[model samples]
Target: MKKILFLTFAALLMVVSCKKDPLDQTPDGKITLEEVFTDKDRTEAYLSTAYSRIPDYFWKYSFFAFLAGITDEAKDSDVGNNAGNIASFWNTGSLSLSTNPLEAYGGQGKGISRYVTYWSGIRDCNVFLANIPKASVANEDYRKRFTAEAKVLRSFYYLELIKQFGGMPIVDKPFEVTFDYASLKRPTFQECVNFIVKNCDEAIAEPQFPLRITLETERGRFTKAVAYAIKSQALLYNASPLWNPTNDVAKWTASANASKEAIAALAATGQFALHPNYGNYFLNQSDLSPSPGDKETIFEINEASNGTFSVINSIPSKPGMFKAGSCPSQELVDAYDMQINPIAGGVAGEPAILGYSDADHLQPIINNSGPGPASGYARARPYVGRDPRFYATVWFNGAQYDNINGAIHTIETFQGGADQLIKNPPNRANTHTGYYLRKFIDPRIQSNQPHNSRWKKYRLAEIYLNLAEAENEANGPTAAAYAAVNVVRNRSQMPNLPVGLDKDQFRVRVRRERRVEFAMEEHRFWDVRRWKILDQTDKVVTGMEIIKDPITGAFTYNRFVTERRNAWTDKYLIFPIPLGEASIIPDFDLHQNPGW
Candidate 1:
């Protein structure tokens, strides 16, 4: 009898152990939400979550925000901060970057570590999603909605992951410490692409995918359109030379097919359309309000309206560049088409307004154009008729820029220190990439002045680029693709671009437009990588000033700024997998990308 009783107790203890780990159980007879969600609702949170997180460097420092800005072929200045020390990420060691620059080189300390923390975001989605079925939400409808939520979150994570680490493990189950991550090997590019595709599809199918009825429908939520955009973007990424397995033509075809499908899915939902006016691409005239106004923005992550909300890494230090980081590279500027060949400007013979200028840059292009606002006013002309978006994005000499209020705008009449002539000035753009980012910021945002500012993580322009590039690469031009690309320019108030542009020429033009349009948004470096054109990166950095002499009635080189040094190395391409991750795996054979 005693032996039988002990056996029964042991059995009961085992049952308790299994059931006691419940996430939603309450002490009372009633089940709590935690228990209910553990049994079910977890997926709801997963399906809808925002993408903005502040790491150490960019949260308060704001220097790191411009990581994207520097990647483009744009120009940036220190304004009056950090002795013009900004401009290193894009111009170093062959204009290339090693995977470990933050660790091995720049000693960016917490920066890289902070960046990888986003993985926790991925992991959180994973854990929450894996447990959704384990929970039992009281409402059946809630349960179904939660399931969709998890998928959307999963898709969002994959989008960010592939961009950084090429292909990674697509974990579906809760990870046990015993889980053999070491034994895990990186999957082929196609595998990664496929996983992303599946997640995107699932996210769209989500019955509860964000429905945009209010101002904040986008606040902390993922929508069906967002998923399709990512899917399209991923395929476009795959079709690029970097991932397409050049030897395998089959992969290219697959990538093209993926893009077409993505577009169709988006269209099928009838959720997204182009935002119309191009001038609204950046945060608009209102200091207190900014909306892409149903035209320029399709989907975007919400940064806080309180200018203090997201410490903007994308913006240069307001009045003075406090952080000596993220200036520009001259090679990026050289990429602009001649004035008559404005690509983004949306019209032919669009005046190409470049930033190069000589010491005496005040000279005028047309003798009557007269001396620049100041002698040696670095200005590029044939600048008119160019894509309106281009002007909105870059801060150029001789162009008027608006103060945050929208009423008080100023044309960049003189270089940061040209009028002051302070040799010992602490903060100013000194390196080759002299221009600074103007596109992604609120023009109303003043230097170092505290005001509510908002930044976008996604937008319609990217969608159009994704569509145009994918369509062009896949089936050639469709009226929709051309219209999509053209709208960005037209709305920017650029002249109308002629149709019938060929793939090769139009593709390069598109590439340059993306570079400038998204300058400092940090897409260029990766875009170049995906396209397999790291070799095109120049090792040195410099800038030019468009000089026209009113007196001579002719164009002359008074000489623009030059880096007078080399800043790039080859290893800057693919970042090395974290050394720690490789150290545990046997035969880790993971070769670091060149320059590190």
Candidate 2:
């Protein structure tokens, strides 16, 4: 009976794959579904298909597409008409219902890459769950584990959808062609959150689910930690200002509890902690696996060694490198705090301890205002005495780069310098913002040698930040909240946030911490949206212009607006459902988001 059922399942998958319709789930009668599940390999292969839609964030052209380009963090250098340059589409405010680069319903060729859509992933999960019990595998434990993994993946898909599209259709089972697509209605925001959280809970309860993946072969598979991470993230989004407009403390409290629980669960395993070296965590090849290797990484997408990042985002003057992709913005550079202590012979608080003179960042907070000899941050030497992460993340005008051929080169982005931005001929490979990204690009990687890269999807530091933000929002700047934020700050050798801060003041500190800590890891794009602060952050991005006076050998600094963005409206808080999906059935009432 089991063998017959498995073949029937295989036949269903064959039919499903052949259909062009995004909503098509009807099984054609060509092959038996039982035949597919009867064979252990086939059954496992079906499960693998569900995992294929997980976003390859490390890939430059995938979902979010090096998201820094669209946010205040950075700007993409690809200004041409390249179809794969999705960031350009966003920077120009070209995203519409009919033409969204970030749409998730349709598959690869339709608009975005094959890995961007989540609806198809959810469908695959539903199909696998409904048919997995009929498989003839000898180990029941394996069957249970597979089922749990599907549930978590489905929940994760929903989480991704909600992050971009707000509430979505809650389709839990495979539908037949005869199923009435017009009858489907989008659920309420809270309803959607509840459903995703419920699915995560179900996956976590499965006895076979490992808290932290220890086996090398099963490295990327969903574990109890992944499920908890999803739950915590969903709750945090729910409690955000965009969703919780009422400023409800209860929502924040719930989010705090969920995050606290996730932290405790991971702690109980004793398998996760902050990776020792803040700069090396992102580029370290030896610590790619979960256990006994960077325990801070709760989930990561491992990729083969490739110099694609180096070729695209490296300094334009470097050999075999092209465009300085996603150049770090001056706004981002200003976020890194100045070192607190003063230089020799300077009073403790005489010099400016902050990075910027004002919140607008129009002027730098200079050290030794009268300027006998600089003690802290001086506008003339703006990069001095900044946070350590600043050194790890940005390649400024005077930064040194070690070449693969055993030579050290000093990067010069000043006017008329070798790496200076070209305007008349417009060298797209040059840095537009006077700084190149140094966070993810491994210095050892040349055009010939690719470095193994891993995108940390869910790290222990993020969990700590989530907890800190939620706890602060719920109960003010409590001791627990400070502790959470300090753990992340201390890892970078930065001083702790000052004590006795008011709630509003602490809020600013938390947001600034996230901006600098996650710099180009794709957090700023979503962080601003969730906090409802896009109008402030997405309006204008600035860049620095350094001029060298050859006669006196003095350098002058100037700030200029790199680009004026067009997509900071409240309507942009959540994306519009793709027109095709929104109007699939005339009366389906999928309900496009307001102001689309």
Candidate 3:
């Protein structure tokens, strides 16, 4: 019989009011906390439960549902068609405190229940930390390491919470059933950031915690690097414009220092660096492996082998495919830097040569616009001479794509083509943006084959970018900041930023670099929110409308609005607190976000 540890506390009842599964019952159908901690296996099982709340970015039910769809980066095909699609809730502006699709308060759902499950996970961590010392079989070293892991996990949960809901009620311990839950209050955003940083520091200082996890068995466990990564990311978010509206240089300096410390700590081990091949880094299974795998990956969630990702995101013309999932927006495609400047007489290696002519990304900067030498960009042939990352990320009209059976097929997204957007009858399964997602879809995974896909939560490139942004904001684009951002650009074979950019110009470059570098990686969703640029970005998403001439075989490209999102208001800067939690508690101190 399978045994289970149950924390029947009134605090838990306030959030997760569901009943336990009968299959998870013990032989006697009940196991107490004392009975659980006395046994090493049960104690370890309890700790494992705490790790279960980490958001799975690949699945449709979790935060992934809204990450790409609600942003200007892509338009999710699943919206408006798929029942219970969470992205639709945010897309149509139908989301309310009571009607939150992402909230899994009952704890009987598939995806990561952002609010209730995370709180439950935090409670589990608290219980494990308080009782692990009582485990008879675990030695002192084992107990210490386990305690540090729980602490790091707790901090991680808090970080995720703050990213979505701003400040949250700090719950450090597992309260009893009789404890007054109404007495809890939300702390200030800075206080929450400090608390998370403190927990991370505590975990890092633990003597039992290894600098890096070298053993295959301990691959996903918390390490000193993971702790540092959590610290760096939290500090970076806190220093962002949304949180630090005064543009505090001290906050930026602190974020930069944290990122610098993280980079130095990892560099000391000499095991972490950027992967050479950008495309193969996501496709190759070996690159996603632990330790001996891609050294760039600081922390990743290894998901079960499932081949549906390729079919779901591929063009509808592909055999055995379902629908095009997140179609890359024309705005996103225009963010890639051109190989040569779009202006005449502009040579190779010159910096700031982006493809678009304006901030709205409506006009393409074509070759030979002026009198001198050609810029290498052509209006008709838009795909040629662009950044290499563009090819790795989006499947354009003429791009060659591999099928499940290892067959090469060219995707044709032009009007009347096989992958065209069929809107006459409104076939929502087609690509709305004239492009399909090419990143993170394994070409080798056949229909019957199962392949393990890893979602990188924290990587070395992000830390470098974080350092660059923080430094640029703190000290107005210093040489150190240039070197950091240039490392990431050089790795992708793109030229470095120009030498004479001021603070504001360098800031624009950093944001653009992040948009292209981390496209579709769940970064764009939060980056815009943190930067407080959602009003400009999320207002309208554009797509390419390619019309092919029947007689001359010439192509005409036009930009059209794929979606005009309604949730771009300032209130959307942060998600509203779930209705149940906000309304159920009479004296609940969790105030709703503005304009909610």
Candidate 4:
């Protein structure tokens, strides 16, 4: 823990005064903070490095893993090394506050990569901001704009900390090497909110919030509205009970107003809007534009036509896209409403488990000659017939799973053919999530195809969810929540829900709608945390299974779920400060969360 913190602090320090290195320069070379910011190329490179450090593969911090697996968004019956534990704890809503297996909590070795890297960017930006004016060179405006951007990134990290662990320290500038650990104390939650808002103010006061398109140069880095959106998001979370369990009405109201102001201001920029089709939102490497009539997008961090084709890295690395991902959870599946509605078909009303005879052939019903169910299922009948997002989010039995061949493969509990997990492997092997994920990755993109397959880091969908949560809290949202939800729903060709529903009911629907709408985009776990609903759900280890009859007769009541199993606990929510760090800091509390 000390080593990690030490590294974090050291990184911050370097960010303070390090100068930019030329592209041809060695990775390890000395440049004071002054020498670096003077050069535009160097400045861009330094900031890009900050973004680059956001950890790839994300076996743990990958936004999707935690979002889908750690909340009630998804669950799997079979187990795998990393996936099952994520699914299990979330589905059960029973995670303990121990060292989170997800490593989502801050630590020396393990942590949200974005947390560390983004902070480093902030530190670097601070160094530039402080030194740019004093630089022997000119272009003061350029240096300050970059400095403003650093503030935006730093604020972004604080937002992450707030969402994951409530209140935390705000370190805007790089500290001297002599900064004392004993002096570091978490600020009041209000302080954190104010700090972020202040940063947003600085960002907005400057020429851009989300770069006014006019400033074309302010493209991806923090723009004026991006700051507002982020502040809005942060204040909204602050208003949430997770940050104020006691219902501090004043804090809640302030946060709502702050966020509302941001929303209105950002809308005024006239740069953002809703993308038409939800299906188009998931970019198929084959096509660049989104699906038709799906234009409800607001602000999005686009990965389109960008990167080294790294977005689809989660798919198996060899055949389709990459071997990095494909982890889906049944917990996620149950959340999607059957095309009909979340209330009617999705999990809200369905039985938790089902009973079936091993002899009952699902293939005959599904148009395949496959065996049937097991004698019994452990829990309750799984939920079904829900929202359209469910179909968009997962692959169920008889569902068409896309890939190179581009055929819809039926979802079945492992009827077991060797290599079924393979694309050409005749049999189907389910992912640890109990179902297959279909949101971010498009299976059709192949090495031979003229496309780049990868996950989108940001999209219009998340903003919609954010608006739903924020607007619902600020005002009894009628069109706000409905518009937000419809923005995403219509993307997938679904009908819009009626507007002006009850606040409580609308809140529930939107939350679930986000789960299905942005399944693998990595929103579920954080959504549950912000909504303060993790306590109400299960947190057990869930996994994948063959669901075969153990009896294995020609036809009998014999079926079983089989796969490597994993577990999650209550402590998993607020990651414990790794054991090593707790030992060194006398003031630090080892108050590991309950289940740890």
Per-residue alpha-carbon lDDT of candidate 2 for residues 182-265, written as tens digits (9 for 90 to 100): 566777777899998999899889998888877777868888889989988898889999889998999899888888888888
Backbone atom clashes (below 3 Å) for every candidate: 90, 17, 0, 104
| Greater-TM-score candidate between 2 and 3 | 3
Q: Is candidate 1 or candidate 4 better by TM-score?
A: 1
| lDDT tens digits, residue span 24-100, model 4 | 23256565445555666766666665544343422233323434444444433222433334443333343333334
Each model's lDDT: 0.47, 0.75, 0.75, 0.48
Best-fitting candidate, scored by TM-score: 3
Angstrom error at residue 155, model 2:
0.9
Per-candidate TM equals: 0.72, 0.88, 0.89, 0.70
Candidate 3 regions with alpha-carbon error over 4 angstroms: 1-10, 13-29, 62-66, 103-111, 284-291, 340-344, 349-376, 403-407, 584-590
Clashing pairs in model 3, backbone N/Cα/C closer than 3 A: none
Higher-ranked by TM-score: 1 or 3: 3
Give the local distance difference test score of model 3. Answer: 0.75
Residue 271's C-alpha lDDT in candidate 3? 72
Q: Using lDDT, rank the candidates from best to worst.
A: 2, 3, 4, 1
Off by over 4 Å in 2: 1-30, 62-65, 80-84, 102-116, 285-291, 343-361, 364-375, 423-426, 585-590
